[model samples]
Target: MRQLSELDASFLYLESANAPMHIGSIYLFDASERETPLAFSTFVSYLRSRLHVVPVFRQRLKEIPLRMGHPYWIDDPDFSIERHLAYVSLGENSREASLMTLASKILEEPLKRDRPLWHITFVDGFQLGGDKEGNPGFALIVKLHHAAIDAFSGAEIMGKLLEYTPKPQPISAPRPWQPRPKPSEERVMLQAGANILRTPWRVTSIAAGAVEATARGLIQKQLRRIPLSFPLFTAPHSPFNRQITANRQIVSAKLDLSRLKAIKATLGDVTLNDVVLGLCAETLRRYLGDQNASNDESLVAMTPLSVRSSTLNRTTGNQMSAMLLDLATNEQNPAKRIRRIHWNAVASEPYREAIAADRLTELLPSAMLALSARLYSELQIAQRYQPVFNLPITNIPGPQVPLYLQGARLVQQYNAAPLFDSMGLVIVAVSYQGSLTLNFTMCPDVVAKGNSLRNHAYASLDAIEQAASMLDPEDMHTPLEETRSQSMADSAMNLLEGSLKKLTSRLRR
Candidate 1:
C-alpha cells in the first residue's frame, strides 16, 4: 500500500455535507455516424477493458487506526467495475438544462469511501436541438476524487481511455491480482510515530527553503520594477464570498480557440491564458453592473499551477502549486485589464507553494493536518476571514484533434473544479479539439442568474476579441521585466568593456 500525499489527503479532510471535493468533467460524444450505436453495456465493456491501463480504478482507500495519519491506497480484492458505473437515460426532448439538472443531482451525493473514489454515469438519448434536428448523442459524467488526479493527470487518463480511430484496439492481458493483508494497528502506529519523528527536521528545512525563495522572489521583483497586486484577503466583500449550500448550478459555453489565438496575436505578447482571465473579469464586471453593485474592487483568482514534469514519477496524486492572479476587474478597458493580468502572471512565480507541496508529505503530521482542515471547514473559518481570493480559475489545455470512444466522436468537453465552504463560484476552462469550453460551478442560491451570466461570459469573449482587433500594433509595449532584462544586459556589456580596458592599461605599464 502507498500513502496518500498531504495534498491528496487534504481533499478528504475538506469534504463536508455542503462541499464535495471531487473534480469532474462532462464529455459529449456524437454517435450518429456509427454503424451500430453504443449502449451502456458497450461503454462498460470498453471501460473494463481499459481498467488495466489505469490501476487507480481498482484501488480503495484504507485509513489508519484512529486517524493517526493520511490514508493508503490498496488493491480491493472485491473490485467490480459494475459498482462504479451507472446508466441514466433522458427523455428524447431533453435539452442542455435537463442534463445540467441531472448532473447537479448526481454531484450532490458524495462518493462512497468503501469503494474506489470514482464513478461514471453514462447518459443517453440526448439530441442536439439545433440544425441537426434528430441526431442523437450521449454524455458521460465522469466523477473522480481530487486525490486520484489533478487537471494534468485527468487529461492523460482521458487519452488512455479514448482512441483516435474507431477500430477497437487489442486489449492487453490483465495481470493476475492478489490482495495483500491489511496492516496491523501496531504497524500503522509505528509508521505514524516514525513520521512524527522525522517531521520537525523536514519542516525546518522546508521553512528555510521557503524563506530563501520568498526573499529571492522579492529581490527579483524589485529588480524588474514589477508592482505586485493586493495581497490575500484584499478582495472586497461580495455575495459570492459567503457560505453556500450543497446544491450546485452548472453552466457551460464554447468559444473558438482559433479566434482566441488570433486575438492573442493581435494583442501583442499576451498569452491565451491572459485573454481567459480578461474574459472572466469582463463577465464579473457586467454581472456586478447588472446587479447595481460596486464594480470598483479588483478581483483576485486562485489558479492551480501544475508542478509535475516528465522527470517526476507518474503517481496518482495532486502535483500542483497555487497562483493568485489579479483579475483587475476594476479596470474598464479590456486591453489594459488584460495587460495588468499579463504583467502579474509574468512577475508571479509558484516558488513557496511548489516547495511546500514537494515536501508536504514529509513536513506535516497527517493527523494534525487533517484535524486542522476538518476544523476549518466544520467551524466555517473560511466565512469568518476575508476571502483569500475572489474565486478559482483553472484552465487546462486538451488535445487538439478529435478523440473517439468506440467510434463515437467527442464533440465537446466541460470540466468542473471543487468549491470550498465560502467560495461560492469556480470557473474551469478546458480546450478540446478546436474549441475552448468554460465550465462554471456555483451555489445556485448565490448566483441565481445562471443563464444570463453564461450569455455575458460569451459576450465578454467577443468584447475581448474586438478590443484586440482595435489595438494599435506599434503602441503596444513589452512587459517591464523584459525591458529591465535588456537594460541589465547592456549595462553588463559596458562594465565588461571598462574592465578589459583597465586590464590592458595595467599590462602595458
Candidate 2:
C-alpha cells in the first residue's frame, strides 16, 4: 500500500461539503475527419487499456484505524471503470457557454472517497465553437482530487494518456490484470508507527532548515533591498476576498498564443507570464471600475509555482510553492503595468526558496495543518486579517504540439481550480496547440458580478496588445513614482483604509 504524504493527506482533511478540493479540465475534441463517430464502447475500451499507466485510477483511499496515520492508497478489489465514467448529452444546445454551465454544476459537488479520486465525463452534442457551428465534436471533463495531483502533475499524466502523433498504431487488448493483496492490519500499524516515531525529529530538522533558509532569504532581500511584498502585511481585501459558497460560475476566452509571445518579444525583458498578468490586471481594473469599486492599490495574486526537479520521475501530489505577486491594476498605462509586473516577478525569484511548499508543509503535522485550515474557515478568520494575497492566479503550461485520444484531435482545453473560504476567484490559464485559454473560476456568492470578468478579458487583451504595439521598450516604465515598497505602499495605504471602511460599514449594519 502506498500511503499519502502529509501534504496530500491534508487535502483530504481540509475538504468540506461545500468546499471540495478538486481540480478539473475540459478537453474539447474535433473528430470531424473520422469516417465513423467515436463510440462510447470504443472509448471505454481505450481507457481500460490505459489504466495501468496511472496506477492511482485502480486504487482507493484506505483510512488508518482511528485516524492514527494518513490514508493509504490500496487497490480496490471491486474497482470498475464504469464507476468513474459518465456520459452527458448536451443535446442541440452545444454552445461553449452551455458546456461551461454544465461543468460548473458538475464541479459544485465533491468526489466520492469510496472510489479513486477522479472522474471522467464524456460530453456529447458539442458544436465546433467560433463560426464552425454545424461541425459536431465531443468533449471530456476530467476531475481529479488535489490530493492525487497538482496542475503540473496533471499535465504530465495528460501527456501520458493521450497520443503525440495523429496516426499512432491502435492499442490492443491486454491480458487479465491482478491487484496486489491488501496489506495485513499489523503491517499497516507498523508503517504508521514508523511515521509517528520519525515525526518529532523530522519536524525539528524541518524547523531548523526553514529558519536557516528564511534567514538567508531575508539577508539577501536586505542586501539587495528588493521591495517585494510578503503575504499578510501587504495584500488588500477585494470584493472577492469574502467567504465563498459552492455556487460557482466559470467563463473562458481563447487567445492566440503567438500574440502573447510577440508581446513578450516586443517588450524585450518581459515574459509571456508577465503579459498574461497584465491582461488579468486590466480585466480586474475594468470590472471593478464598472462596479465603482476600483482600488488605488494594486491587487495581489498568490501565484503557485511548481518546484518539481527534472530528476524526479514521480508526477503526482503537490510539489509546488507560491509567491504573492502584484497585479499592478492601479497602473493605468498598459505598457507600464506589464513592465512593473515583469520587474516585480524578476525581483522576487530569490524568495521562492524560503517559502517552498515542501518546507512549509513540514512545519505542521498533517492533522494539525488540517485542523488549522478548518478553524480558519469556521471562525471567519479571513474577515479579521488582511486578505492573504487576494486570490489564486495559476498558469498551467501545456503541450505546444497537438494531442489525440482515440483518434479525436484535442482542440481547446480549459481548466478550473478548487475554491475555498476568502478565495472566491481562481484564474486558471492553460495553453494547448498554439492557443491559450483563460478561464475564470468564481463563486457567485462572493463575486456576484463573476460573468462580467470574462467579457472584459477581451477588452483587456486588446488594450495591452495595442499598447505593446505602439510603445517602445524604453518607454514602457514611465512611472510617476520610481520605487514601490514592493509596489504595495506607494498607493496600497489606500487599500488598508478601504478595508477598514468596509469593515465599519459591516459593523453599522
Candidate 3:
C-alpha cells in the first residue's frame, strides 16, 4: 500500500458534492472491419485480462482513523470488475449530441469510495463517421478520479491500454491478485504520528525554498518587463464567476488541426497555442455579447501546464502548475487577438519555475492544506472575493497516428474535466489524427446555452482564418492594428472585406 502524495490527497479534500473531482473522455471508434461485432462480453473479458498492467484499477482508497494522515491505496479485498462496468445501447438516439448529453450526467456523479475510483461504460449504435453509413462505430466513456491520475498520467495509462497497431495483440493469461491484510488501527495511527513529526523539518526547508523562488521570479519579471496575472490579484470578477450549482451542461466542437497550424505558419513568433487561446477569447466575447452581458474587460483563464519533464523521479500523482492569462476577450477584431495572447504566454513562461507544483506540494503540510481547502469551500469564501482564476483550460496533445482498441480504430476523441465552486466552466482540447475537438463543460445556471457558445466559436475561428489568409508571409510580424472603428458601418465593412477574401480563395482552390 502506498500513501497518496500531498498533491493527490488535496484533490480529495477539495471535492464537494456539487464539484466531483474526476476527469474523463468520450471516444468514438470504428469496429466495422472486425470479423465480429465488439460485444460487451468480449470487451469486458478484454479489459479484465489487462488488469495486471494497471494495478490502481483494482485498488480503493482507505483513509486513516480520524483523518490523521493522507489516504493509502489498498487492494480491495472484494474487488470485482463486473461491478465497475456497464453497457448501454443508444439505438436510434445514438447521435453525437445525445452521447455528449449522456456523458455530462455520468461525469457529474461521484465515484463510490467503497470501490476502485474508476468506471467504464460501453455505448453502442453511434452513427458511422465520414462516408460509408453502414460502417459501424461505438462510443466508450470512461471516468477516473483526479486524485488517482492527472491528465498526463491518464494518457500514460491509456498508452498502456490501447495499441499502436491495427493488428490485435494476443491477450496474456490471467495472473491472480493477492490482497494484503488491512493495517490495524494502531499501526495507522502510528504512521500518522511519524508523518506529523517529520512535517516540521519539511516545512522549514520548504519555507526557505519558497522565499528564494519568489525572489528569483520577481527578478526575472522585472528584468524582462513582463506582465503576469496572479490569483486574486489581477483577475476581475465576471458574470460567470460565482458559486456554481450541481447541474452541468456540455458541448463538443471539432475543427481542422491543419488550419490552426496554417495560422501558426503564417504568423511568425506565435505558437499554435496562442491561436487556440485567441479562438477561446473571441468565442467567449461573442457569447457574452450575444447575451447582452458586458465585455468591457478582457476575460481571464487559468491554464494548466504540465511539469512532468522538469520534475525528477515522479512516478505518479499530479505534476502541474497553473498561470492566469488575460485572453483579451474585449478585442473588437477576434483575428487580431493571437498576437496579444502570444505575448501573454511568453511573459508567463518565466514565472512557472516559482510556482511549480512539485515544490509547493513538498512545502505544504497535507493535513493543514486539506483543512484549509475544506474550510474555504464550506465557508463560501470564493463567493465573497475575487476568484483565483476564471476557469481552467487544459490543452492535451494526443498521438497524431491512429490508436486502436481491440482492433477498433479510434475516429474521434473528446475530453471532460472536473469543475469546482465559483468556477462554472472548463475547456479541454484534444488533437488526434487530423482533428482538434474542444469540449465545453459548464454549469447551466452560470453559463447558459453551451451549444450557442460552441456555435460562436465556429464563427470566431472562421473570422480568424479569413484574416490570417490576408496576412503577408514576408514581414509576418508586422503589428495587426490595435484600434478598431467604433461605428457599426465600419465594422460591417471590415467583416465584409474578410468574407470576400475567403470567398475568392475558395473559388480559386
Candidate 4:
C-alpha cells in the first residue's frame, strides 16, 4: 500500500466537522437548448469511465495500523452516486444570503471517510434572472480531500474530465471495477527489509540537504537585512492566528484576464501574479478604509508556490511551500503597491528554501515523515511563533476555452480551500476561459465585510485597468480622462457610498 505524505496525512488528522478537510469547485452552466440535453444518469456514467484511469476518484480510505505508513486507497464497495449528488431549485423569494446559508450547512459537515472520500452534487434548475439572460442552469459542487490533490493538479484533472467540443456519443463503457489484490506476507516482509536497508542513505542525504539549505538561508538573510526590517517580514498577532474553527466560507467573482494582461503589459516587468496580489492589496486597503479600521499595519498573506516539475504533473498530494507576502496596503497608490509587491516577491527566498527542505523531508521513510509531521503539529498546538501570516492566497491556471460538463455550458467556476489554524481567509484565483475568477473564503467574524471585500476586489481591478489604459500611448488616455467625467465621478461616489453602507451593516450585525 502506498503511504500518505506528511503534508497529506496532516490534512486528514486535522479535519473536523466544522472544518471539512476538502477543497471544492462550483460550476454554473448555461445551455442553449430548451430540452435537457444531458440527463443526470448520462453524466454519472461519464464520471465512472473517467474514474477508471483516475482511481483516486473512485477509491476511499484504507487506513493502516500505526502512523508507520500512509493510508491506502481501497475500492469503495458501497459507493452510491445518489448520496453524493443533490438536486435543488431556488424559489422566487430565495436570496443570496439564503444560498450562502445552505452552502454553510453543506460545508459544516465533513465528508464520510468510509466512502470514496469525495463527492459531487449537481444543483439544477437555477435561475438568477439577472444579467444571465434568465437561462435555466445548474451548479456542480465537487469536494475532494486536501490529501488527494493540490490546487494545480486538481485543475489539470478537471480539464481532463471536460471536453472543448461535444462528443457525438459518450465514450464506451468502462471495464468492470476491481480492487488491487493484497500482496502476500512474504513480499511485504521483503519490501520492508529493503526499505530498512536503504533508510540510512536517504536519512544521510536529507541531513546534508538541510545543512546546505540552512547555510543558504542564513547568507540570504544577512544580505537582505535592511529591506527586511519592515513588518512585512515579521509575523503578526491576531485572533486568526490561533487554533482554527472547523468551518469555511466561499464566495467568488470573475474578471477579464485579457484586461489584466493589458495592464501588466503596460506596467512592464510586473507579472500576472503581481497584478493579482496588487488587486488584493488594494481591495484590503479600500475595505479597511470603508470600515474606518486601522491601516497602519500591513496585511500578511500566505501564498502557496507549486514546486512540481513537469515530470511530476500527474502526481497527487501537496508539493507546495508558502511565502508570506506582506500586502503593503499602507501604500496609497496602486502602482506603487504593485511595485512593492513585486520586490517583496523577489525577497521571499528563505521561504522557498524552507519549502525545498520540505520536499527533501518527503523523500524519507514514511515513519520518519510521520514523526516529523507529529512534532510539527505539536508545535502548532503549542502556538510557538507569532502567526506568520493573515491569510492564504493561491492562483491556479485553468483552460483558456469554455468547457462543457454533460453538455451544459460552464459559465463560471470558483474554488473553496481550507484555512489553517492561524489563518481565517483564503483567496483562490482560477483563470478559466479568458477570465480570472477570485474566490474569497473567510471566517465571517474576521472579515466583517465579506461581500464588500468581493466588490472591492473587482473595483481594484477596474482601477488598475483604468490606469493601464491611461498609460497606453495608442489609447490616448481616453478611458483615464473619462474617469474624471461627471458620470464616472458620480458612479465612483455611488459605489463608495454603497460599500460604506454594506460595511456599516456588517459591523452592526
Highest-lDDT candidate: 2
Q: What C-alpha lDDT, on a 0 to 100 scale, does residue 103 get in candidate 3?
A: 84
Model 1, 137-167: lDDT tens digits are: 8899988999888877888888888999866
Rank ordering of all candidates by TM-score, starting from the highest: 2, 1, 3, 4
With a 3 Å backbone cut-off (N, CA, C), the pairs that clash in candidate 3 are none
**How do the residues 2-56 of candidate 4 rate in per-residue lDDT, one tens digit apiece?**
6566577767765655457788777677655436645567767777667655667
Model 2: lowest-lDDT 10 consecutive positions: 200-209
lDDT assessment of candidate 2: 0.76
Best by the TM-score measure: 2
Question: 84-144, model 2: which lDDT tens digit per residue?
Answer: 9999888755677788888889888899999889999988876776675656788888999
Q: Candidate 2: misplaced stretches above 4 Å?
A: 130-133, 200-233, 349-354, 470-473, 476-509
The alpha-carbon deviation from the true structure for residue 485 of candidate 2, after best TM-score superposition, in angstroms, is 7.9
Candidate 3, 248-367: lDDT as tens digits? 787878899998898887767788888888878888888888878888866777777787775544335787875557677776765557877776566443233324444434444554
Task: Compute the lDDT for candidate 1.
Answer: 0.73
Q: Which regions in candidate 3 have their CA more than 4 angstroms from the true location?
A: 129-134, 200-233, 310-315, 349-354, 358-364, 471-509
- Model 4: residues >4 Å from true position, as ranges? 74-84, 89-101, 128-133, 183-233, 238-243, 313-315, 347-354, 357-385, 466-509
- lDDT of candidates 1 onward, in order: 0.73, 0.76, 0.73, 0.64
Candidate 4 global CA lDDT score: 0.64
